[model samples]
Target: MTLMRQETEEIPAAVARLLSSAPETIAPVAAAFRAFDPHVVVTIARGSSDHAAYFLKYAIELVLGLPVASQGPSIASIFGAPMKMGHAAALAVSQSGASADIVAMAKTARAGGALTAALVNTVPSPLADSCAYTLDIAAGEEQAVAATKSYVNSIVAGLSLIAYWANDKPLKTALANLPEQLEKAEALDWSFMLETVSNAQSLYTLGRGPTMAIAAEAALKCKETSVLHAEAYSSAEMLHGPVSLVNRDFPVIAFAARDAAEDSIVEIINGVIPKNPHCYISSDKSADAIQLPFIATGHPLTDALALIVPFYRFVEQLSLHRGLDPDKPAALKKVTVTR
Candidate 1:
């Protein structure tokens, strides 16, 4: 815990402890919504959680085939019209479970007859209060100003819901092994990311499976810690229009996983590496073939494990490479409040 805590002041050791909470421990949460066949899902969150929402949305849709949208705080705060509420269930993701505007939005969705849920670290919070179901991240107390364990845990929890809801056997098995994979990812060397990302003007993180959310998480780390202009996209989406522009000038980060989409995603990576040539890769396998395990999420825990490892290292190292303190980010705080 000290090794995890020493890197950032606001981040406490207890928060990192949440990483090991078994998903099966929260099996009751998955059981609670067994009856719900939501037409769509709308996620309400801020900053880091919002980014996690993006990845979760992609994962749920890719596997469950249910439409999912992440509401902008402004959209839910000012519009007053509940779009996600009309036909979909609402999932509010927060570490604090106290963001005023997102809570308000989730309440609005609940009042509109849509089912509601909260993925949170805090118990007895406004966000949890508003939803009928609460999927506790059980990440315990997050001590770091920058969210590490809770954010990853929330993504894992959400993926569990998606996997269970879809009831895809192979996908479920892959996700179940995620926790071990994450541990492996944590041990992988990431010194190269610091050396490489410093000189790049722009970077891209690409993924397809639940790892698409991993790409988004990676991009957030790049910007928050290093001030790099980084963006994430689905591997297929990157090849659609953005891929044409990828060349030697850009460094591409691929979030590869053991999902059905791996082959096509690998193909997309093949296409980009030849063009951009500055490819950074993360996985839960031997570092021999790819760039090595950049983070811990590549371990058996699929989404959850990957959530902890690759992006955390990316952010931590990017901070070191730039001589910036990871403890306090530029113009950011432990909790974000919206109007």
Candidate 2:
């Protein structure tokens, strides 16, 4: 058990390198899409890729306030068959670039007069061919059945796309500084979490604002790495019914921001804490927990993207410590199929 020696440290470093890769890897794309001021954005993918795409939609709309939607079979499958993509930006998110449905949607997006882009881990997949512009994540070969490297890489790549589109100098600077923060976070100890969260059979995470999208990533990483069942809900949605799950043993992670709503968000955390379940909180402003200095959309998304690395390291270590093979969780595969 040399746990620290595992790929834990390399995870953040590799993701950092991938984030900076966009300047060089996607320069051609930068030149290609300079003219299109796309209004409607639609995304297509499956599993983790799709999850990252949802995060992207939120990021783009949140910062730019442009409308974005996830393109389903109605517009995607019909293609030129009476139903059209209708002047929207289409993003095909795929790890392998082999998913035909994603490829077709990218083409349909182009056909419908919307500029299309491919956010992918693989450089030369079919999905890339359909999109006029592409950002290659360069995550390398992800050997695990559930994604680790590729998921973070995808988030970074998506951030780069939004940053580039907005010509955001602050975003570029923030991303440059994000890697070191993640390195520091990875090296830190999380012994408290193992005793508090590892053995738990179920967990819940909540976030609002930009963190609302980040919650999805946190939930996915929790499941993939530790195999502890976890669910993510928008902060508002949790009050609807999910709040009833609170108990002393269950762990809850609340994501709050340093904003006008900070008081309300903290109140929510306080309300959840007395429910007795162990709780962890994260914010760029918090003094006690992991602080990424969430710098709005620019550096924060990059930092938020890095947020998963520490959790991954903790969960992966817990998996091995518990005599479970994290590389192969039962009944799960890297790529899933659906009809």
Least well predicted 10-residue stretch by lDDT in candidate 2: 289-298
lDDT by residue (1-339, candidate 2, tens digit) is: 333235455666766777766777765564555456665778887777877887787778766677878877335554434335545677888888876667766776787777788888777878888887887877776667666667667767777777776777777777667667667767655556776677678888777755666577678767765677889987777778888987877788776654444456555666776675476766543344333323332354554555556666666777776677777777877655332
Q: Report the C-alpha lDDT of model 1 over 16-108, residue by residue, as the tens digit.
A: 343345345445555655566667788888777886787787777767778887767666677777553556788899999988898888888
Best by TM-score: 2
**Which stretches of candidate 1 lie above 4 Å from their native place?**
1-25, 82-87, 163-177, 239-249, 283-290, 294-308
Taken over the whole model, the C-alpha lDDT of each candidate is: 0.68, 0.68
Please give the lDDT score for candidate 2. Answer: 0.68
Report the Cα lDDT for residue 97, model 1. Answer: 90
TM-score, cand. 1: 0.82
Clashes of 1: 27
